[model samples]
Target chain A: MAVDHNVFITEESIEGETAGPLAGRTIAVKDNLSTAGVRTTCGSEMLADYVPPYDATAVTRVTDAGATIVGKANMDEFGMGTTTETSAFGPTRNPADPERVPGGSSGGSAAAVAAGEADLALGSDTGGSVRCPAAFCGVVGIKPTYGLVSRYGLVAYANSLEQIGPIANTVEDAATLLDVIAGPDPHDGTTREAGADSDYAAAADGDVDGMTIGVVTELFDGADERVVETVEAAIADLEARGAETVEVSLPSLEYAVQAYYVIAMSEASSNLARFDGVRYGHRGESDGNWNESFAETREAFGAEVKRRILLGTYALSAGYHDAYYAKAQDARAWIKADFDDAFESVDAIASPTMPVLPFELGESLDDPLRMYLADANTTPVNLANLPAISVPAGTADGLPVGLQLVGPAFGEETIVRAASAVEDAL
Target chain B: MSETPESDADTADTAAAAAAAVDAEEVRHVAELARVNLADDEVDRFAEEFADILDSFAALDEVPETERDEDLINVMRADEVREGLTQEEALANAAETEDGFFKGPKVS
Candidate 1:
């Protein structure tokens, strides 16, 4: 195993119950998830040494289910970047190819699973963090239906768009991990009992026979030629196994990336306001007044985080609120309706998990817009608050390309089964 | 669903506001609003970057007008007191605390 993946920001073995479903398994939790007594840095200097006083509902669920938490994994600072290079600690190298980045902000979680450092790992997906990393690292990741899993204790970044999910080497293993962490938490009011009562692991039975998959052309339009070819081949494989695909169009695709960023940044600006250098975040000298100290102390946040916060502030600013944030919300409504209309005739939607291949280290770091554009295919799913999974479809020019399967809201089982079929077929 | 009024100039102005380039002064102001201190050079750089980002966001103008039905429901529980974090636990991570209260920078 490669030892330099920088997959973990903090490594400590915490053993769970003596016997349960995950007794023999190990997990690498993203640093944003609070683990009691464990330092939970969101890869930002602001919270570099901050440890939570209580366990996040997901952490408690996993530990109670008998899983051993191996460590807090590295991530893009505040779940802000797509390439994981924005992590304040350092970038997590893709285990598949050391020079390339593991897609992030769940990069470290996916890298740990890919490098065999853990049996499974937990990652939070907001605008495709979990699936992007899983795609680049040749693993499976599931971004559950928005309210299926509890988000309590998660370091907030775009609260409405993010969810704590699972990353593992296979669809079944990922589903098994999801089964443990997913459920309604009294702590998080958005959580519902939708997929909590179903057997997600059992649903991954490679049962794509008779499943009707919708191929969203909008998702395919801007993808790399090689990636599109590989995903097409995977769909063909599903057809060989008795599944069928139909071309579908979501006209609102062009606005999704814009809408997603506006909403995410706007939410992030508000969410990150909690780290004002008091009550557990990095503290500064007490020389200045409260607001001054806050500005001075907030300098600990890295460049990408600052960028998001500033833009988010601008989006919510008085003169531009109607122009950006409100319009984005309206676009979100349209995108959700389009998805509902598409799902009326299809069981699931298929696309390339990422529009391009794994980026070389420091490639798009200079151009933030390029990085945002790369998320075109995955952002729509988040906008609609749907469940999607990234399964290793095949290699595109010796680089892994993931096929994304998106299902209806609370439709985890269908996506898991379809993802398992893709896994089996490939 | 309410339609975007075709004759409303205020709506047109709203569409144009996001596409305008944010100057360095505005960037610095926004940084202050966000509570992050940035160097002057950083402020200039952010202005240029924000311009590019805001330009991309101009595409939202084309999203068809529709009444959005966001499915939001309140999850209510019985109004009963539950075990909560104790004062000691709450103050455990505070960098400066006295008399069971967190200390902050002076206001004056």
Candidate 2:
């Protein structure tokens, strides 16, 4: 089989021992996840030749469950861009439409599953990375509640806001992958003790009878008309299957994108400091002083990464700290409050996964802010630290539109149940 | 605590001033702090980009402060020792290694 998509940087098939939950399943792990003896570049030239010495927790869990490791998938450079175009290896083409992007930074994981290169794939979601690609590629992906999956072996990028998630061809498959990977690790201190052993596969009954779903108005504002209509029709189909729908307002969502970028970039600035030339990846041949050598070596970073680091440094600077970072924290809290209030009246909130359809390659690369705004609908879910799933709702023209279902913290079961219904509808 | 706040006009002016605050000099300063080298043209490009990006983030100014930070608590683990990467494994990916240690440029 010709693998046309620029999906995998390294390819191998290591089958697990027989008789486990993921027996015989093939999975492609995003390159950011450490694979023992495999080159995990994370789509950055700085680590183009770097190979990890150990496997991440998620990798261990899946392999132990009998899933065959297929390869290391591509991603945005250090998971910085909305499109995989920033990948030093090259952009991953959308399996659905090769001309357009496979929304990133987990685009390769989604494309791998969509193209049948892998039965399921592992991807990380730092502010919609996994879900956005899943939406654009017409697959199912879930960003589990923060701390549900251990981050021990995954390379850090905006650590506080990211979780390793599963991308699969169906809701059940995604949940099954989640079951194999979701748990607490002594190594990753932030992982909680709940939902580690929950049987997520059992939640895919596809029955949303009497379940109340909230339609977020702010998420609908400024969204493409076709995308809104497609999502609305999907909800109506859910309502026809005995689900109640209500219009809910998360007024603070207007500020969520801003808050998400500030917080993510700030955390990224600190987390990425360990990439100095002495420790890992590429080292420059500079004979200058230590500071100059370090700075010169860091020049290998791509444009988007540099922009974010600079912006993050600015936000966390002394005089502007209270004005930018502090305000973002307050906005995050308010958005979380809004979700908490909405969940009381509804089982889960629903919105269009992405505010717009997938654009062509290099279309939004020139203006970074325009690309950031495309994440408005999805960032709120990450900010609130809730579980969410993106399922293919319907099609706009020939492109796929994803309908997202977000639930209360540790509420992956609710999200899976509702998304399963959406899966059936589309 | 009951003192009157700024008027809407004043807030608008303040927002505009804050939006324009990220100039080329600020971009250079931040790049230095981040320890990432950028060329002169790149600094000018980033300064323009920062102006637009930061302006969009100004929406956070209107959001009221909440008590979320109070809810955050550091989770403590038992002081039990666990197996970690060995010396060889830790240094496996390093670019320049000396006798059992990673080497870097000499500090002046």
Candidate 3:
């Protein structure tokens, strides 16, 4: 059914249980997450033919919950790019509009859900991979707190910032998926018990009475006027439903993009080092020289991936480590403090998920800086290690606009309730 | 280490200086360090793009001096034999293998 959208890298059905919480639901698994006996390419040539010996913990949990596996969804190569165009496979066309790109690196997952190819999808958000595509495709995506979901079987992009999240057509379905996949996994030690046994689906009651939401001024500034207006109208609807909105400022947001990139790329450089063309994946011609072969093998990476790895290597190099990497970490700490301070006064903070609307394919490809800067609003939440949800608020110029709600650490239910309220209004 | 800038303008100045630190040679060197083989065109293009990227990171100069949180938590695991992927499963995806081992490029 989703074959026309270029939304899946591998389109095979895996059988599921007869009955469970997700009975009969179809799920699109992001290529970056491992699925046993299924090809897990991460949309890169190095891994184009690699099949995992094991399933990611999320995959196991979802399958056990009676959700049928629809296919391995396409992604930006190793989850590096914002738009899915960087895939070794071709770009996933946005189901909403074929000309405009589906925001990525989880473009296929969001596109699949938006196209009704799958009932739900799994995506990894290192920066805004999950939420960006979710916003662009006008679907609901949740980037759980850093340790809310297990990352054992995920192809590590950024160890500290990434989490496996869900994308679905509605707040409740996404929350239900979260309930199945959330909680502790022994395979992933980073997972804590905070979200263990979560009843997040029940929390999506669409009731926002007496809730105080912090409308982040920084997130709104510099955003497209149409998107801002659409989000503003959504905020008004929330107010009409009895939720209070206060203008809160996180000035550290000004530094979020740079800090997020420096840290994520640095971590990516380290995490991706395991693809040495030795143990698994693609191999280069030895030519009797090991080092030369290794370097040649890595040539399989696309331009964006190579650029990130190089920049990451530079940031962590001896002469520049302190100036780039360390400073970025300091900014991260400041961002965390800002969120901590904000949460002390308000229940949650809100922003437009993406500053602009769905990008026309090739629009931002030539300018990597423009693509990086576009992640301004979503990256702050990841830097702070907070939970965030992007729910389709409305549309601008016939494209989707998402309102992002951020909650404190382990506050999945709070954001779910807030997002469901938006859904109810819609 | 450079001193923290006193103002936004100073931060911009420092960012420019930092961005200027990169060149074609530096891009090539970093590519080597990253095990990526870039062609001449890529080196030229990346040298230019990397500068723009580093310049945008000027915001780092204004980051408050917060102590790095290095409170490490170790997960203690029982050292015991565990049932894991068999040798066949482990090498199932290898590009080349011999004698039940992953075959590597021959040493020069």
Candidate 4:
């Protein structure tokens, strides 16, 4: 099939699929996820013609639960950037405001759900990719606890941080998709053992009374006024519903983005080594030299991808490994420790998912440092291997602001319960 | 190199020299290791970009060294034989494949 250049990569509708559990529903997949017999580009020219023989566990779950696999959505090349502008394909525009970017690199998945092209979409959240876009697009997105969902077929992007999650219009829909995808899978060894007995959808309606929610003091201090106000209002709504709110500090939060980048890029540099243009996808027609062809093919990758790979390689290089990568790992442990200590006091932590609202498409593309800083508030959850949900709190200057609910590692049940109360209040 | 003999008028020259000290060859070597080919122009471009990036990373030098005491376990599971994909299933979507594995141009 000739791929559509728009948000969807394939347009074929599945026939004979009745309105079952998710019947009459259509879902789009982020391009980085493998969809059997479908072109999974990862928004890279290197994989422009690649197709996967097997489906990602999340994609299979979504389809088997009666949702139609609508298409492969675009993303930042290998999920490296904050804006969809980094996509090898042209950027996906925010359905609400065409001139502005749909926040990335799961921008297309979020936009597809927002634009009503799909009832729901699957996106990988490695840092803020899913949630930030969902916030920008006024949708609900969840990054399940690390190992809650199998990563067996999702294209690797910082393996420890990435999770295939759902993007939907409402918290209930997101929960339903989460129920379908979150579980133990032998295929991915890191999947949590506790995933076997938990049904996320059931936990979505669990009681919220007596639940103590902590407000991360650092998230609000220097954030945009409107963003803080919206999240604060969401907290008020939770308080109205019998949830207690308290202030908590995570001093290490200040260093999360820095630590996140070093570790993510370091892993990315190693993970992306598989796409050398020889074994799969587009092999450059070099002058019959194997090494030269590999080089030529990689040269075809976009600038952002190359930049991340280089940064990662440098961080993981010998001599500097202890200083950068290892130190970042230690910082990850400290960040997790901070979250653990706070969770001991509260059932969950709430914060504004991102400090700033969505900006224009090309606004941060040229400034790499500024772009890296955008994931500041959300990266800690990944570092802690915790479950977090970004639900629409309200709008600020007409753009949505996400109120993030974070819980302890494998504490998805508590987080989901708290999020449901917040959802109900909103 | 005699530390380049610093002088008040030589500040800009010193900065330029510091930037130039970030080897273009090293940048290319890193790029090769990452499996991303760099054009000669990109090598020059990235060398400059990486110099600035490394300058920022130099901040880590200020961080007090910490003990290597992390409880990070490899977290491995007991290896067991399990249900697996058939060779036909495994090779089903390869643009090209051979005897139970993906086939490609020979690597030198």
For A1-426, candidate 2 gives per-residue lDDT tens digits of 564888887887767768799998999999999988888898998999898889999999999999999999989999888889899999989888888999999999999999999999999999999999999999999999998999888999898799999999999999999999998888888888886778998999899999999999999989999999999999999999999999999899999999999999999888878778899988878889988888889899999988888888778876667668889999998999999999999999999999999989889888899999999988998899889999999999889999999999999999999999988887
Candidate 3 residue spans exceeding 4 A from truth: A1-3, B1-15, B70-72
In model 2, which runs have C-alpha deviations exceeding 4 angstroms?
A1-3, B1-16, B69-73
The local lDDT score (0 to 100) that residue A46 gets in candidate 1 is 89
| C-alpha lDDT (0 to 100) for residue A420 of candidate 3 | 95
DockQ of 2: 0.46
Model 1 spans > 4 angstroms off: A1-3, B1-12
Please provide TM-scores, in order, for all candidate models, with all chains considered together: 0.96, 0.96, 0.96, 0.88
DockQ, per-model, please? 0.50, 0.46, 0.45, 0.27
Q: Where is model 4 more than 4 Å wrong at Cα?
A: A1-5, A14-20, A205-207, B1-25, B55-108
Q: What is the interface RMSD of each candidate, in Å?
A: 2.7, 3.8, 4.1, 6.2
Q: Candidate 3 chain A: worst 10 consecutive residues by lDDT?
A: A282-291
In terms of lDDT, model 3 sits at 0.90
Looking at model 1, give its docking quality level: medium
- The alpha-carbon deviation from the true structure for residue A55 of candidate 2, after best TM-score superposition, in angstroms, is 0.7
Tens-digit per-residue lDDT, A29-116, candidate 1: 9999999899999999888889788999999988898999999999999999999999988999999899999999899999999999
lDDT of candidate 3 over A64-168, digit per residue (tens): 999999999999999988899999999999998999899999999999999999999999998999999999999999999988999989999999999999999
Name the top lDDT candidate.
3
Docking class of 4: acceptable
lDDT of each: 0.89, 0.89, 0.90, 0.78
